[model samples]
Target: MIRCTGVRHRRLTIPSLAANARQIAVIGPNGAGKTTFLGLCAGMEEPNKGEVTLFGRKPSEVRIGWVGEFPDRTMLFSRVYDEIASSLRFRHVSCRESDTRVHETAALLGIEGLLPKATDELSGGEKALVAFAAALVHDPEVLILDEVDSHLDEEAGRRVADAIKSRPGVSVIACTQNMDTAAEADLLLYIEEGCIRHAGTAEEVFEHLKETCFYPAVWRVRGC
Candidate 1:
């Protein structure tokens, strides 16, 4: 479980959103502090007034895997295979097992052919895949994603969704802008002005939000 209290980032004062081991989705308009809130949850930033925790443990106490919006930044090694296999090798995984894990993740992400290619040479989407491969190799208890779909098309997005669903015991928290993305979410949070206007299942919040927020009316209801 992760928690935030009196969370303030720069000018945004976010309320404490406690995640008690369930999957959560954060959504709202751009600049609504969704990413900032996620950063705090991921322990990338210190809060202005409150604290964050993971199951009564700090983020350091719990292993965290992340796929940032720009994945190329996570790449360090010369070759894609090296970048993917680096952590596994560091953990002393057997050579045969490490190769198998890397190839398996690559095939799952459709980047197997790029194993020998330089990490510096892959496209943005391909780099995203490699970064994802690296994150999943260690299999952390929690995965935090920030706008991971920016560069992906619909098919790529589905592949990611599939990967997320098949995993077990790993809790996921994500910040996204796509309403369609919210449809796949089990728990959805609608944030407005850095506070939660609503937090519930995707259907419960998303359904009513359309009626509450003002939009150009298409037709007049029978009310006069």
Candidate 2:
């Protein structure tokens, strides 16, 4: 479970919020503090007040996998294999085990063929897959994605959605502008002005947004 109580940082504020769903989508306008909320959840930023916890422990104490909008910026190693193994290496996992895990994660994401290639040689979509492989190699309890699908093509976006589905045990918190993608999440958080205006299942949240442009176009067309 992920819980936030009296969280206040910068322009974002949450008096109370708890999420136990396996997949939660954060949707909002460009500057609605979606990333700020994700930052707090990822432990990348400490809240100025209150607390954010994962499974009863502070978020900082939990193992989390994070993939941001630009994976290249965070890519530490040039080689794909090395990049995927970086986290395991930092944790002092045996080289053999790390190698096995890296290959497994790459294969899981259907990026094994690119493992031997240099990161710089890959395309943008391929880079995102590699970054995802790196984040998933360590089997984090929570996976946080910040608009990772924004730059991806349809195929790449589908691959990301499939990858998330493949890891049902890991709680996924993704901030995305794609209403269709957001509609697929188990829960939705509609944030605005640094506050969550709505939080519920897709049907519930979309009902609240049905009159607004934020509602899924497909749903609107279907009158759903």
Candidate with top TM-score is 2
lDDT of 2 by residue, 61-176 (tens): 99999998889999999999999999999999999999999988887777889988999998888988888888888989999999988868888777777877788789899999
Which clashing pairs does model 1 show? Answer: none
lDDT for model 2 comes to 0.90
What C-alpha lDDT, on a 0 to 100 scale, does residue 130 get in candidate 1? 79
For all predicted structures, in order, the TM-scores are 0.84, 0.96
In model 1, state the lDDT of residue 64: 78
Worst 10 residues of 2 by lDDT: 156-165
Residue lDDT tens for model 1, 163-190 = 7776878888887766666556678877
> Residue 147 in model 2: shift from native, Å?
0.8
Candidate 1: TM-score? Answer: 0.84
lDDT of each: 0.75, 0.90
After aligning candidate 2 to the native by TM-score, how far in Å is the CA of 202 from where it should be? 0.7
TM-score of model 2 (CA atoms)? 0.96
